[model samples]
Target: MLSRLTQRLTRGSGELREAAAAAGELGPRAVSLVPALRAALGGPDGGTTTPDLDADTAVAEALWRIGQDPGPVVAALDSVFVRAAQNPWGRWAGVRAARAAALLGPAGRPLTPRLHPLLGDPEQVPAAALALVAVADPASLDRTALAEAVLDAARREADPMGALRALEALGAGALSPAHRRSLAALADGDARVVRSGVEDRIIRGDETFRNRARALL
Candidate 1:
């Protein structure tokens, strides 16, 4: 299975993505596939940053999950963050890298500088905030400000899940008085929170998110 996935990692982008995900699920057992995953990020040396941001993120994440080595994996993930920041269309890769960092827990601490500025980016804020909470030292981060950014993201971002996840990471104790008030309103079914003219599925999803947020309170 590892050999087949390794082969797929060198194939087209679609296969590479699927293979990377599959290898990640294999965890440390798939350590043998690490070199192939690295090569998928760029050339045989795996030092050349690839233009394909999504593939780079996937391969980096797979390498991290495999857990044989972290030095190159951290470098690769950092490359994704840097490249994605430079490319307007690469926003999703930034999101994925932030998420992958969160998955790495304390080992992801090296990416803190890259993650901090992302809090100002509406598209990247939630994921970046979540990653920071996972990787940053509490003494170094202002939890109130992080909650405020997440609250803003939850209110205005197209997808609220990341914001919600970040908020959960911050937890109820971290919320300021104003933050709780705003979240209470959202939980109570503020029309703005649900939005209008969207499908019922979206409305319901928003409601579900509201309940989950409320649970955090």
Candidate 2:
């Protein structure tokens, strides 16, 4: 079954077509497409070298695979980041780092300082930092520096999703009253979908977070 699925997914039409069609018809078996999706994204023509439809599809596909298997997803993302760093569009490296960070499983953390260069820019730093916090061993993080970075990212990022991700990584025990207030404010943003799953985990008592947010225009 896996071999047949793999062959079907890697066929000429692209994994997205197979993934979507399988998702619509095969139900749970569609999950098998995840690895193929990542494979295609990180493939020679995976789109990491250029920001085109194929690249966008690769990122989206990788994101889906992360939801399915975060460990492999993080590894794949790490590869993408390395490739992106080597590419001509190296400036987008932070963005790729941030995306990789977001995909990391709770136990995954980079021991190498590859992400440090991007951390200097608040706009670029928070997403990558938040992803680090999400996956890093708390003992591994430099608490003082990470706290400062999170605050800076929260203050500088206009995107609610970015702020929410950092806040979620800060977690309930780590957050101050001010952070809670900021998260509450984000409940109404156009980017609420990005915060939904993570925020729902945070505001465990607030069943209304999901319902009220859903009513957004």
Candidate 3:
């Protein structure tokens, strides 16, 4: 199975991403597949970036999980971050790359410069802050500032799961008195947060977000 997946990574087949993900799940046990995963990120032509951002992301993540090599994996992730910017749906991919960088733990320290700038990006801040916590000593980071950024991100209409995850990373102690008040208001279904939307799914998701917000208090 690993050999088959490795073969898939060497080509530009549609299944390349799934193959990389499956290889990543095997973790260090799939170390032998690292070269193939790296090859996949370079595209079938070797030097060109893969057009499939998702596949490139998967391969990058797999390389880190299986090989623990920071250089190539970080390069691959950088490519994802750069390429993803061209598409409307790119933020999601950026979020994933942030999380993948977090998986590197302190070894991902090199990515701090990139992550720091992302703190201003509403869509990426939550995940980026979380990644910072993962790669840096929490003592070195300004938790108060990070918490504030995440709180702001949570207010966005797009579901704030990233914010929730980021806040959890920051720990309950990171919350200031004002932050608590804001969360309390949100939990109580503040008019600002409880919007009248037509999609039941979004409404239900918001309700769930509220419940989770309340749990933080």
**Global lDDT of each model?**
0.77, 0.51, 0.79
Report residue 73 deviation for candidate 1 (angstroms).
1.6
Pick out the ten consecutive residues of candidate 3 with the lowest summed lDDT.
Answer: 42-51
lDDT of 3 by residue, 113-216 (tens): 76886776788998899899999776789999998888887776433777888888889889999999877877785464645467786678778888888887
How do the residues 17-52 of candidate 2 rate in per-residue lDDT, one tens digit apiece? 444334325434556556565554544344444343
Candidate 1 lDDT by residue in tens digits, 119-186: 77787888988999998887898889988888887788435877878888887777989999988877
- Candidate 1, residue 198: lDDT: 59
Two-way lDDT contest, 1 vs 2, winner:
1
RMSD of each: 2.8, 8.4, 3.1
- In model 2, where do residues sit more than 4 Å from their true spots? 1-28, 43-71, 87-97, 110-116, 157-161, 172-217
Worst 10 residues of 1 by lDDT: 42-51
Best by lDDT: 3
Report the number of backbone clashes for model 2.
Answer: 0
Report the CA-based lDDT of candidate 3 relative to the real structure.
Answer: 0.79
